[model samples]
Target: MNVGQPKHLSRFPAKTDLTHQEFWRGLPTLQAEAVLLGPGRLEYKMLQVTGRDLLIFRSKVAPKMASTIVPHPDWVVLMVPVDWHGDYVFNGQVARPFDVFVSGGPDGYSTTGEKRHNLALGVRKSSLKEACANLSGRYIEDVALDDQQIALGAAVGTRFHRRILETIAASLEKSLGSGKFALDAVVENDLFSEIANLIMAETIEQNSVSSINLDPVRVVRRAEELFEDRTTNPPSIADLCKAANVGTTKLHLCFNEVYGVSPIAYLQAKRITQARCTYLSAEKVPPSVKDAALSFGFTHSGRFAKRYRYFFGEYPSETLNKR
Candidate 1:
């Protein structure tokens, strides 16, 4: 995470020649699990300001996709969806285009949308606090908690909020022609301050609740971690419930809220992903598809092949033979 000055400052054309791996590698932060939901080629374009701890970027994704993201630890992202129609799920709560969302630290989030254009700014936690304090005379000590609560409470956007977003976009467009230059610290600070002031002045604030009530998100995250750790020997639903300290019914609800799937189904999907990775990475005489599937906990080869094809749009054998 070394921030350097952006060498290029132009809005590039929509790049359609990226593979799934290439697209994932280009993302600034966040570990994403992505699934292309449409048949057409994925189209994307980005305008980014490089080389500063406080960075601004706008990107558009066409031909719908579903993605789950784990945010970066040191940055807080404020995102405004332009020409975006879909819901973003954060901590089990959903936010729409007119709602601005904030995220900090490592949190799980999911976005499913069609042809989305988003303007996002990533600022370090310390810079964000300084900006907010300079603008509003108040500081946020725990940004991740505050952002989660805001998302859970559904912070709605107002006319002024829309105007702020428009202004920010306009500023980015103007700066695109400025060429490569080291971003001045004072200039970066002022820019962040302006954005923070707009957010503070326009967005509505709700009451903060205690952490005891927010245990469901934590439980779901813990279950996901456990599934990842023991992919070959995943825990049963009952075992997961015991580990998460929740009942079967509560676990189901939490899993559905976060992943749109039951715990068992999510685990199965993870196993399939692991199997695909193993199949693709095998070198010097790859393993048979059956062996790969069974190695990742797929008991029945036939069922595993069907599930793998359905999820990845290719048969397991096809993937196994590619390399």
Candidate 2:
């Protein structure tokens, strides 16, 4: 096992003296401390940057008119609207609920009022680069994921991302580690990487939406159906065209326009994700990467490895070993 000490970032005890009115003044200070140094606080919880790519943040901000927050050198803020809605101006763009946007550079500000905020997970630039090396400094200033609006409560991807956010929050609250040990250190890093890659994949799609034109809703649905049926092997672009009843060219255009990556690339990523689950499960002695690649219609191991690493920031072997 890897040996390391738990990095002790600050931990705040629950404060009873904090009034709702005083929340505004304290919010920036908390965020600054966390983003700048380490963990910072708000209401009953805290925000912790676990590693290079993951951020575990849970805060309840009362209300405020306008507040400014600068970016940190290690992360780019991508807010996924959970329980509140407001105009967030980042790099001169106002992001609304159900809308995925990123603050350019390493800093930005947030403005909210009387919103019981749940969580805001920050995606690390390094983790993202590890996952999508081809992106190489691209989409650095934008949302970085698919564009089709997932209709506040219905989008599958949206729901998945939020679920991850909630899971991290829950995990942090139940953590037994004193923030300084070996086992805990490894667990924290693993969890952080998992969260980072999940968010990174989503943001990559979000930022690339302009290049894809297929209806976001439809693309999500079709992709889900395709992924659910493991037995059925279909060509990505053609299959999307067939599923959506659009011509090949239109399907390609729309899918690329809405998701940023070609439909096939997206499909490949989905397949790889499926394989990751299988490989990580204790009930199975997962297929070799080559066999998994073939099962997913990826015949070329080299190409599959490249794509798999791009989607998840690690090779299939590395991921399997983690299991």
Candidate 3:
């Protein structure tokens, strides 16, 4: 478990800023929300990262009313509990406060509690993998060893690991300040180095573990190609699984392990990218955002709007009007 002074990220009131929904529709970014519940409901604080990989938010919650927050389809989250007790589920894994857990999805992780103190960080998948790749050789059949066991030591090795986690956490806090633009790259590098080092060292020590044997690399490559193809309908997950000749669970893990996001998230990201470009190109048409979302396969406009707000900040109308 990692611990430090809690830091508050800058919050943009999502409910008040209607145009913020449009901003998310136009970019690839990491976004986060910190909610402090009151009487019935109060405005949640939103932080949208335009050109960054890491985000951190600390919230003060009440002890009786639970909060359910859903993130966008482009984030993999890490939650550290500073206070309270609750069930934290990511994908299918359930975790307590002291245990560290990782999961990939476009939709992000979820937590419910009346009152809790927590630190939430969301990093982009591509950035995450690139960061992890810095420790290329230590990977056992492409699966990094860091995710295999809980790292808790007090030696030179443990101290070093602690330092790395601290650096990453500190860099995240820096993102909430004026030097954010510059600190983005720094944080990514530090995070990657730390993860790679830990994984590589553990891999060397744990040589007894079996190696991974799968075709996720191929599956991911084909999936990316399908995502890029806009002419006809691309292959579904099953089709791609067949095309790659891998099991569904293996394929899911591979894509997530390599890309830091699941297959579905990758597809949705592609659709959103296309929709943004289309929306930006047709300022003269004045089409509804719903129509624009539909053009790219986002059938649930309200959900799309919420995701848009998370990724960008303004609603689609604001994006159109700004053009």
Candidate 4:
């Protein structure tokens, strides 16, 4: 695959004569309701790749301004503030600069003191799940950050993190400008995978501080046992919580602390691993990807293929073909 310019791009130039409605319309992934507490201006831009969406925006609003964001179901939002001060309140927590917010849930609200500039990435859920699988051997659908925010602090300043961010920024800039390139599909997949992995890894590593006290060792072992026993049909989060004799919040914290992924994500990885093993072992006459997926409780072959590619960095067909 060759790397080339993206086939589609959208830009919304900065304008001082912008209404709240206009600013809301310019947002890429979410339908937001913005209330301007005082005078200010908003500028927005967006770039779309095959499977990912990038957004850059700057909002100058009053200290009391707030916005409610509702994200698309199939996408997860990653907010990285570029230049700004003040905090965003979401999920009953405050998010500040250098903190990345990853959410794919109910309506979220954010408020800033004054001016705010940030880059938000809208990634498909499958892509993020695959990234989590690659990084932690788990298929995490969503990561709940500490107080709904992952504080980068000195972590973002590190050479490694800076390099990854720079690379992503450069790619976006190139795609936004000349818009000419020959990027292979597989190569593009790998590039996005790497970017997601780097960002998630850094976020997980830096946000390791958990205020909740729980026996991570015990919780992990019990959860592992439950997943092992019910490999064919995994238990739900509620079931896991009930079996573990813990609430949902504690379960999440415990799993995150021990495995760097949620319980459900770990279960997903286990099932995918099982499916892969079955497919690989069917040597003489392999079952089709669809067959494997169905045998493992996946009804949608298209989504299965995407998740499989994200998790293993190759298509299910490719995996079977290797044999």
Candidate 5:
């Protein structure tokens, strides 16, 4: 019976372009961290809207990078790619334009890409479950209640993908926050029902890699934890292997399989990324780049600057001067 237009939407201004920091700060995620993988400055654009029970974002980013995003604890996030100029990986799976990547877990998801355009929706788990239960047309049995994260995909011209586009349009538009009307319960139910029906729809079109063993993922995660916790002395391959409880050969294989990089290089990339943060936030130039480098375990100035440029697309001095 509810008929009012949406008034629950938060008033986040639409953005045409943003710096890497601005873009990361704006994502509705918890403890989100991003690292640059390609050289040069990054370009990003984001249009965002939020509701009490949901958040929607239309965004694009360039120059290729990786991000570890931990979304709201009570919500299930769905990422739909509208344009993918290069490989886009989400949760270690290649995200195609046809599939809607979905996840809701404590561990969150890892995303990396270049020249990617996407629509992301974060819907409250309780609200979504209620909507699925109350859907009038679809039988209750169609919607699986399993807790595992999954990507739902269908062939082109299918109703599911079309409805996703429609959802993105409605969720990202300002109309939801305009005027006297409110997005009442009835309208919300209808919207969620549309999503629910599509998600539970049979015969999804999917041709992705088969399930991975997941042991490699665990090894990488353990190694990251050890590296992050270490100070003054970086762990050697032996230490990393001991921490990960795997042999050196197995550790290398796992790291490469998971991140497409060897352990040492990948960990080094992470270490320097912390230094970039200090530069990004510095009010005035820090006393010296070498101080920052040496503190983060970079002893050789030439090697530090070269690696910094590769990861952030700028020299340490240049990044220090940006702000």
Candidate 6:
């Protein structure tokens, strides 16, 4: 389990990360990889407190768009996004600011993006199961992976969000700092019991919500695979269509639904950043700007430069020359 160091707390406590990737994101224990989906330098931090039974963290990431695969597994996790000011999508669902993301029953895979001021907690699945069984006086079946809207009453959501923050604060004080924070078993039990009770009470608000349409997820995932496989020569719309096996209309709608951008626009943004990576990581040969663009299948030099500048805030030439 990778734990976070309380770096920069004295000088920049607001920016310190109490939990590194593994403690909150389930690294090494399970499979996880993150690819940045937005432009500019990534500003990421987490304020986290962990116990043997549970781990909670406040994640703050800017240029927040990301494609994450299995960040948490064998753990039931919830995310309360606080002050997520703009559009965001989780899996195939367009999430509201106050919405809670309950996942980790069967498949804990999630891809979320844009603005992510989120407070989340992960309880070991077996522990949660035992808790629910003991608390509810019966075997409990918690929610399956929620691939749909889960409406949270405004007051209830806010209250829970505050509670989570308070608990973290208290844990920090008890541990004496963020560097060596861990929840006492009693604290963990009480907090986790609340989560279990919430689930048992069916407070997650999914019954009335519509079931998620998986078509978009399938479409986008297929296209993403194509992009990954053909990075040296990014696939055309026709190629994407064939690979995804969807018509142009369905493709456009589904792509926009999942990523909030049309296929072409998302592709340009993704592929352009990749080209910059190429320039930065080039070993033997000093890759020229033109070569980088062409390697990412950008045929039109003017369009490539424009897209590069638009996404990265600098011209491709500037990046290559710097490299």
Top lDDT prediction, candidate number: 6
TM-score of each: 0.45, 0.39, 0.38, 0.44, 0.47, 0.52
Q: All candidates' lDDT scores? A: 0.56, 0.46, 0.46, 0.52, 0.60, 0.60
Model 6 misplaced stretches (Cα beyond 4 Å): 1-29, 71-73, 140-149, 174-180, 203-323
Q: What is the C-alpha lDDT profile of model 6 across 252-300, one tens digit per residue?
A: 7778999899976776677777787787775756577765665565534
The Cα error of candidate 3 at residue 315, in Å, is 51
Q: What is the lDDT of residue 219 in candidate 5?
A: 76
- Location of the lowest summed lDDT over 10 successive residues in candidate 5: 1-10
Clash count, one per candidate:
3, 23, 15, 11, 5, 0
lDDT of 5 by residue, 1-323 (tens): 11121222213333568776666564456777778899856767776555567665667776778988777676777776655656778888876445677776777888888777676777887766544533322233443433233445444324444443343434332353321112223224334545554454432222122235648899788877876676434554444655666544566678999999997677677768877876776465564786676556554557889999988899999986776
Query: Candidate 4's residue-wise lDDT over 162-188, tens digit each?
Result: 432333333342353222112223223
Question: Model 1, range 26-118, lDDT digits (tens) per residue?
Answer: 445668677888766665565555436676555677767877766567677776554554554444555543555666646646677776766
lDDT of 4 at 212: 60
Best by TM-score: 6
- Where is model 1 poorest over a 10-residue stretch in terms of lDDT? 1-10
**Candidate 4 global CA lDDT score:** 0.52
Model 2 lDDT tens row, 220-279 = 566457556533343343344345544434445556667777765676667777767767
Worst 10 residues of 2 by lDDT: 1-10
Where model 5 places Cα greater than 4 Å from the true spot, the runs are 1-14, 24-28, 136-187, 202-323
lDDT of 3 by residue, 44-96 (tens): 32333323666544344443343333444445454544445454333345444
**lDDT (Cα, 0-100) at 185 in candidate 2:** 29
